[model samples]
Target: MKVLLFFGLLAIALADNTRFEGEKVFRVKPVLDEHVTLIKDLAKSIEVDFWSPENAEQVTAGTDVDIRVPAIYLDLVYTMLQQSEMEHEVLIEDVQRAVDGQADTGPSPRAHSYTKYNTWSVIESWIDSIASSNANLVSKQSIGNTYEGRTMTILKLGKKSSSSKPAIFLDCGIHAREWISPAFCQWFVNEALTTYGSDAQMTSLLDQMDVFVLPVFNVDGYHYTHTNNRMWRKTRSRKSGSSCIGADPNRNFDAGWCTLGASSNPCSDTYCGATPESEIEVKNVANFIRKNKSVIKAYLTIHSYSQLLLFPYSYTYDLAATHNELMSIAEGASSALRSLYGTRYTSGPGATTIYPAAGGSDDWAYDLGVKYSFTFELRDTGRYGFLLPESQIKPTCEETMLAVKYIAAYVQKNLY
Candidate 1:
């Protein structure tokens, strides 16, 4: 029996070891400060799944680069960068070989099923099933049409009141490669429904506040992620006479529109778009938020693999008008999240947290007087990045619940 069990486990491991075997790691150091921008501009050659400054205090020897990227095009990407004579070394060979050896080995393990890179259809089906079972699901009339005409879905959870209720608007999957973002949205819905009557805080909060979640903010980019490259970020809008496709939807928001941290080049990752809200997906959400700005006291835009909790003023280094209050709330939420598993997450302004990004939804939301606007960068710091394993989903969602509830509870209590 032990022999049989051993073989069974071996088979499962073998089946789940479908990682990037042909890929190679590049331990690169920047010759110029704009080296990252150059590589990002040529993202087609060498793909970067994760990129960050090795700012962690706990640094290992030969790990100063401090980025973990998992992709099939690593070798080709390395070749392209090598041509540029960038100083680099191979940090870790066969990283995923170590990954599967350490990751979850249980029944229905995420490293197993989710490794297949499940499509939007699979996730959409799950959303449909959950919404059908829950009574509080209220979808808005489609705010606008996408470039491809996929109907953008916005779900409002909690029971409807006879009168208006202060709302919290949440959106995710603005950048396509961040698949984990959309998963959190779905998880948030499931929790809200499953815990409605079971959890008092959730019940009372939902009873008072309407939570509007647009599971996938960039529907076209999301669809592109499922169909094409796994690391594709930005929208999927095609510009006339320009070969480049898509704009950074975050850079297309109305506030500060695209004054800084944005690109005039259409192919750039931070292209501000032809105009503010040019991308229909951004337009849709912007219009929806505009129409309901009065009630949206708290706004959250979810992204992944950074382990960050960021608030507004990303376009510039300027502190928000309600900086003190926003900082207080963010600190409390981050502290609550860490209490669970000691999961490490940094809390700060968006510009300081990662990079200064213009036209982001958080900034726009805050400018619109949704002063409690925030952005949650979810899951493992770099181990998984955007390709975070499914097994980690529950834990990520579970720990995140504390922070979310902390914010939700605070918002509900402060309501006039």
Candidate 2:
């Protein structure tokens, strides 16, 4: 039995290794109509993975576009760029080298470290341990199962109260490749537990409100990223008739239902599900939020590769009803975050700040009456992209903690 178990774990470890040998990431500065059209045309011509500005549709004049090109297309991409007269630079030369350099060392069975990017199994174990260890202030709840049958666990953090307290629903890793997102969630949980008594603000917030932390929102996709592909970004559900494996959970919400900045085609990275909440993972979360609507005063979803603090209404160009207030809080949080390590985060409604991404969780949460809903795009704007180094985990989480605490402090004080 022990021998069998050992072999099983070995197989899992071997499968988790992903190598991206000769791939290159490029940053293109599209400054004209022709440049933007070229980017769109290039995407259609080949499998160009847009890292920044999200999709080819968002590739507008004067915007910086980041894209990952396969080894086979590198020469073609370079030649086309030269002919088109578009200004561009290589951000990453050898993706596998970057991936190898991202981590400090080879994998070891050391106890889970918040500063390290743990595998899904390690995170799962850490979740169990942390929740069990801090039972008084943190309790675990399995909201549902992922498409691949992994349990979706949420940790509720706060002092136990006689009655239900107004809460904040915080989730991370909605897009699997954004590893730093889940790291922040875990860090937030640790901070809330470790600082409760000594930190007056944290104590007061806990005394007054609850925080629900879904450490990894898209469990299946996240696991897949660790096991199969380092850049996989959607849920891991297979459609009966389609070959596509997943839907973009972030783009699977019901706010605007795939109208803008999203694709109906299953093969797209930003493919909205066949319908809103079509992904079981999204449905489970939406159902939980809907059931707890009366108490969930704020919704915070974390993503990465752009340093932005965004609020609702990404589905349309129209501003959110609480746009000004949301902007103020986001700016304040951004400022707080900047004070630590000088990281600057642009703050505004999602549509104007970034692009018109429909069916986002923040938008759906806001429309569901969670007025303080916000989405955080964390870490370096594009240097690392989704493959942010593990060494950065500490500082990233440290700075983000300030912004999150700022939001939590504001939510606590403003709760009616």
Candidate 3:
């Protein structure tokens, strides 16, 4: 028993040591043409990790670029930025401190709460309980399994009907470190169940359309974040002949596979994988979406840190077929979201609004005939980034709820 206990304690110690002690996240704004090349050169010289925009390749003039640098390179990075005359600021002075400060220190909990960042186990249990408690409005389906054999459960929320109803598909946490993404999904479930009859918009939404919520899209990576690394951001899949263990599930779709804004290197954060649908998690979600393409009208995939509501064609500069209508709806949704907290969100086509990210699920969904497809990048511009505090969870989710409801209501009305 003592031997077993010692090994268990050693495991916990190793996990806790994964925290970023001396790492700092810097936000730099490039003004001159040489500044971009300077940032690229910095990445090539050292292990500079791009936090926002996901890659150094997306760093451009007029946009704030956030990158986390190792302790040893902090002085060198600051000197380089000064010499290059690039404007920069430290967003997070200590990354480990920010990571540690994300969770609530109030008290121990027996059950999951919407305001807290719950672990994969807590979330799984909450799903079962919530679906059981709200039997008529919520039911779960095991769509498929992750690469690590963890079950991928999607919760279907709607009023039971004799016949099938048009549905909207919403998924969150496709990239694992964005804890707020999954939190919003769980909060959405809570709001839907708690305000089913009282909230007029929600009631009408359930009455007209079924909403499928995949609360945690990247199960394996999410679990890894809680157990091993707080910043793990890909599906935990091991491929033969590669030292790396995961692929960017967001970039694993068939739409413009391995194109711009994605990496062919297996070790990259935005690694597109061996081929389209290379990750089992992506393949599973794709298969489910394909299976229910007839009834699924809208696809909303939630992400974080950048305040943007984007539509399809992220793979290319080409505008989506339904560009005008999608842009109008996105602007409306952004307006609704901003009304709550005065939090502004830019609305436009993903490629033009941001950078060209190929193989994104929204692009693929739009190509698959899901006309009303969108991707939501939620909360604070760059102050918090991925390490958003737990206190902001309620406000963020509450405001996001408005935008999601607005979209759902619109989709229901325009279901013709």
Candidate 4:
């Protein structure tokens, strides 16, 4: 009896250490009326990482939800979802494994692999290296300081395009838990440097347009995720008269405030702040966009797990004046992305395609008159949630590069 009890306790401890919750992303196609309510209920019961028309058609028609799951519980959830009668497809089942930064791979290199799986300190050094190497092409500016006093840096890639050339703004890792988000930012920079001369499209882009890249918007939250909890999302700034430690910066934008699909409870993941731009980081980015409104024609923000391409109207799912044009461009980008590896990506407006999320960066950019705003949810459809492995960094970014270039080319041709 004593031996059996000991084994039972050991088993319990092991299971608890593997206590991973699935970020189950579903490619859910809904039957318009029946599907809308179903998706909502599923979101209520299980967390929906992302939702948009790009990935799913409106509930009035067939729509698929791209679901993501954390590493530990992926198998369990995937098997369960597979057995369910719902018409769901699992696009990618790659798992993001969590390992020590100093895992015994070999002797440490001379310098940190700052562009990959890096902390804020490493990232700062990496940026400094790039700037020092390419004095003419790269210039850095401190937009402002985050709550923790870390500088919010922005890289102005390429000369500001002609007043009529149309500019695109790219920001990533707004949510700290999505490490892969920042990875793409660094990958973008590497690609730009490596292929600038040989890649015709890239070369043309460099000559014609200005790309503003904010590698990580929520620096404090990102740092916290690395040192403390792995799943920490949102900014680290505390609100007055409340004990909640952070606010969902994405949901704290000024566009629609927090009307639908946002939580007021500070503890909730989707908590919107007391007011729009409540977080200093958001204000800094917003201010930059506002200051550059005439030239900043497009805004592209990246997040992870869900393979989605979304446009404006996150506050509400209704179509925009340029909805037809934006939707058409998104479709083109999706097709380009698919060409690389038959990777399937959905494109559509925010409200009709996914849950109503107010205060999204894309929507705010659109409201600020940056009409070509978009949000790309990158990498695995779900098996490994936020722990996307370092191995996938190359292919994921490469495939995404096609879509970005395609969009840039399209914008160039149609720039008015």
Please count the clashing residue pairs in each candidate, in the order shown: 1, 0, 0, 32
Which runs in model 4 stand beyond 4 Å of their true positions? 1-110, 159-166
**What is the C-alpha local distance difference test score of each model?**
0.71, 0.88, 0.89, 0.72
lDDT of 3 by residue, 169-267 (tens): 999999999999999999999999899999899999998899999999999999999889888899999989997789999899999999899999897
Clashing pairs in 3: none
Ranking by TM-score: 2, 3, 1, 4
The parts of candidate 2 lying over 4 Å away from their true place are 1-18
Best of the two (2, 4) by TM-score: 2
Cα error of candidate 4 at position 386, Å: 1.6
Candidate 3's C-alpha runs over 4 A off are 1-17, 106-110
lDDT value for model 4: 0.72
For 1-416, candidate 4 gives per-residue lDDT tens digits of: 12222222322111212223323344655555555554454344433344333112223356555554455445444444444445666544332223332222433324555235777777888888887787656678899999889999988777443354456789989999788888888888878877877888887887787778898899999998877766678799887788668999999998788777677877556788878898999999998889889888788899876788999888986788899999999999999999998889989987766557887888888888887888998877655556666667667888998998888888777667
Candidate 2 local lDDT, 280-333, one digit each (tens): 999999999999999999999999979999998899999888888998999999
CA lDDT for candidate 2:
0.88
> Residue 313 deviation, candidate 2, in Å?
1.3
Better of 1 and 4 by lDDT: 4
Selected candidate, larger lDDT, 3 vs 4: 3
